[model samples]
Target: MIYQSFSSIANAGEETCLNCSTHVVWIAVSIDGGISFTDYQVYIKPDVTVGYGHQFVNVSVDQAGSVYLVYNDNHNMFYSYSTTFGQSWNGPFRINSSPSNTAIFPWSSAGPAGTLDVVWYGSSYYDGVNPPDSYPMTASWQVYFAQNLAATTPNSKWSQTTASGIVHYGGVCESGVTCTGNRDLLDDFGVAASPTTGFATIIYTSDQYVNSANEPAQPFGSGGGCTQSSTNSVECSHTDIAVQTGGTSLLSATTKHHFQITKTDFEQISNNPSLTIQVTNIGNEAINALTAQISGLPLNLPWTPALSLQPGQITTATTGALPATLLLAVGTIYTVTITANLSDGTTETQTVSAIYTLGAGIGL
Candidate 1:
């Protein structure tokens, strides 16, 4: 069931836009399993000048139906595979081998038939460190994940598996948007596997452009935006959505260790001021028990509840989590519920109603 379609993401679809100008084009999609798909394409740059169009393209399918793809250009991060399923595809492989400006999102996880489990979002490929000595010199982002067995060696078909599973974003910005300025958008994605314990799970999301009229938040790309230090930080990266899980067969599905919750009251609460918490447990193991609450607060001065979090703050917390360092209020006329454990083991639940103010607080 793989068949994705695209056309101007506000990038404008000028005359059908086939990879913008070619050079490298591949946004293809067509599968009949995940359910519904026939054919979609953009992939074409055999070489307008060295096949260059590599913009956000991701495709995965394994287990026997071979098909893998990845992207990211500016310096590196490219790979291709297709055992005739996608019609025919191969080598593009560079794997962030070198250069700079790195940013990959390659994702995959289809095992058994020939083994596959790719991942991305890198800044230091193999990690031996080179390029005049680099590793967080700017906005270093890392999440590397790998798997592509079903062989003996040759780099082992595909390798990486995740020597790193920690890349995050969250400088927060969304009311009027201005942790500094604006710019941040990552997607929420998923991939899973558990032959029994070969274990594998993934989640994604990233965006943190903290202020931009130009530069910093980047008015376009080419120049503008900095803060990566070996993996420095900034860009207000928030919108958090990253879950990781690896071989352990996911402990037989789950003996217990999952949880999730989200809240944001103001549906017409009048007052305005606090309450805004989010809880998650995408699973990779970890979430030993939790809790949260908020009945009302400050005489409703700024209204309060299961949201509005951080700024001055309120109360209610569990094993302790909302964003992590602290922030989870539960007051100001609202409701929130949470439940956990997932990634095989089982158990899941969540309740919500962070109400909204229809008059002065906005939400009418």
Candidate 2:
């Protein structure tokens, strides 16, 4: 299934909505193994009347196929639900856990046979005014969560939970306290979660709980500059949720790099060989180095050769290492080989080729 930012109307990640010119839309196609697919698109519009009134990001559908959406409207948090496979819909349900308002982080997941858990960062006000409960802390919302498996979509009972998120007290404080702070500190689609035997658990970021390093009651300077009541302006804080899975592995391509070189007319020494090369890292845990070897040569002239390269695994970044220099003997051509050994007890080799014109001795 493919998801996007509401612009893929004609599909292929291109389409956009005509009404309201809003790009907040979604489409999905459920593929059956390698056979066929069930496709559809459903638009979610916020109701300015009842709900908090805003758009949402990050929507999740459980095994039974229930949809939960979260977003921020006017700096405030708002939520909504969708059943019937996203056919018709329902009004936005208020998950107001912020003080003044907040920009919803918009992420959710459901247990294998359990309930759906959604999370976000914002004020923990609960009250519809300025003085919030915890002041924009981490919050969680669970719907129809029970010790047992789920029976259907949109479970009648859902639970909401909010906390002050963890705090980091800097080792160096004016009065023996370590501290730092930040909200909306993260942006990405990766979070730690798991579901087992109808019971699901999740770990997310939060900075709600305000605890002083010296002790729970002992504040920095004992509320020297700012009173114990207003800690937001004094202490520094930021929270990140690390959810460890059973195990994880890094990609192979990240350990190696690639580089390229090119040559043109008047650069060839002679055309007697068309070269193709491949490299090998005889014995090593990683390809810590890359260089060209031109044994059948006349002079120490750089090949300025063009090399072809291929990577082994997927990566988060688009850059890789390339060859810096290649000196070849014409007709003798050259083979640019790459060898690598990774930390995971693995190694591989890739070769590239180039052609040289005969009798041509690098004419000026």
Candidate 3:
């Protein structure tokens, strides 16, 4: 068995002391049959003016003794990893890809070879797009998943994916003073991963409709008169747990592509005389063709040759040579804009600036 710990301000007294003013979270572990354990701080903040809710800390351990901790700040979900048990950690990385949305109730599981997956409920209401009065009791909570290929490493990049359609609803408190009524929020969600297959299953709570005879009803205001009488009709609080399964083999067919300038080598016009830029594809689909264009330079840089890239592939393009006529002064900053057009009918642009230095320098 394994254990974990977290912090909260709920136990604070009325006196305005440090403990009462600020909120923090921590985690601990006991590997040897719960005999002894080590503690590690997850999040800490000194300032007490801004209230912080550090809650929902979930922990998962892999066969290799690596520990993963996932928690929420009441607004977003963040995760951290500990290679040396609970003595140290690396992360507190935001698990939710969308910063504007509210993410909470994070749960995680570790699969074979230290593959980690985390899930949370993402709400759109917090973004001010779906007000309760307009669509009250509707499905606003969406389930999101993030996977870490190398869960044992601090530098592991998380790939975010959506698991369930926006059908899960309820668990949200009403507006105003009575908002605290649904504080429990349907207990919690859970996730598990297969040690061999690396497949993951997520189980979470959601509202549903039941007939008067206690039978399941169709979703989305279908069977049974379970919807609210108001304009933004929502089903009554009939929380039910649902499950969803996913793995690498069950990838979505839709094509997606993410482009980034991974590396840039720049130098003074008189010294190195050329600029090298590297582009990488971080998505799940192959890039049919890619075109790179650079602007904000003294000379009109031509577009790079069209190239093809598989998922997770990197390609480099360099300016053949900077003409000596372009006198780039030392310590002068120059903006560089790179636009990439993909055959997938998508275009991405990155604007970066670099200072003309004597030695090699980097751009975004």
Candidate 4:
């Protein structure tokens, strides 16, 4: 699981082997501009039986630098959080209140103001059904959502809600002999949150009706008017992607910082090598200042002054034409390193090496 934070990149995965008797979840954080990462264990539990659904792990980062992780274990959904940037975790709390039902494919997102939302599919009725206390492998499933107002708080309870009308018409089989055409909702779901509005959009796949077909004539020995023969069998089911929004009002405004260098170009200007670097503020919030530094050249580059870069906007900084003495010789490699320093104390760096060559008349 890869997540983007205000000032860093985070990821979560199983540190140990999935086939091992015991499995653990590890979260890694890259604060030095995503160049290196530090990892920590979030939780550990007994591995699920082989041939079961895949273990899906998800991670999200809030505006305040808190990290949230959710995964499925033992046919139930659970979540844990880290406040110190993956240094420590708070809980393996079960999000689903019902112990008898199975919940899987958890997807989590964080709002601008530190709110966390999680959605999953569970063995519950599609319509309004309180306390989903039944466990039927082949039963219908519904979409469920939970909200955590204070994600960093320890042992915080999640407010649960069910999105009605969506149904899952699939099942898991234990043995190959009893396997039907039923399929498992493989891997994951999607969820996104707007940093400006705090509105969340959840998308998932469900087996809805695909088409209708006429019934086939049945034989005399058969007790039905129409038989489900191979020719007339209606495998008319589709894994449809459905989208839903959380019913919540907009939250307060929050500040975010995301600075990145989108592209870099190197060329010869007037027979002298030159470089141009483009930067962007890929975050929801604005950046006040960013500085660039170039290395592997004799010339001293100046820092870019306080630059206000809005989201999706790009800014370019170039190295002026080199002196005549700095002209490159053919068949020689030159290396350069460019570093961008944001006002928020975060730095991003890029390195490039190019082999220089003159026109056809030039010789090495």
Which candidate ranks first by lDDT, i.e. highest? 3
Cα-based TM-score, every candidate: 0.24, 0.36, 0.52, 0.50
Regions of model 3 farther than 4 Å from truth: 9-22, 35-38, 49-55, 127-139, 167-179, 183-185, 208-215, 218-364
Candidate that would win on TM-score: 3
Poorly placed runs, candidate 1 (over 4 Å): 1-42, 46-61, 75-109, 112-116, 121-136, 145-194, 201-364
lDDT of 1 by residue, 304-337 (tens): 2443233223334322112233223322224444
**Per-residue lDDT tens digits of candidate 3, residues 263-303?**
55555433455666666666655566544433334433433
**74-169: candidate 2 lDDT, tens digit per residue:** 344444444443433453445443242333444566432224455554432233442221334333221111111232334333344432232311
Name every residue pair that clashes in candidate 4.
Answer: none
Q: Which regions of candidate 2 deviate over 4 angstroms? A: 2-25, 28-56, 75-91, 97-103, 112-114, 124-155, 166-184, 188-193, 197-239, 242-364
Give the per-residue Cα lDDT of candidate 1 at 355: 30
Poorest 10 consecutive residues by lDDT, candidate 4? 1-10
RMSD, each candidate, Å? 23.4, 18.2, 16.4, 12.6
Whole-model lDDT, model 2: 0.33
> What is the Å distance of residue 61 in model 1 from its true position?
6.0
Count of clashing residue pairs in every prediction? 58, 61, 0, 0
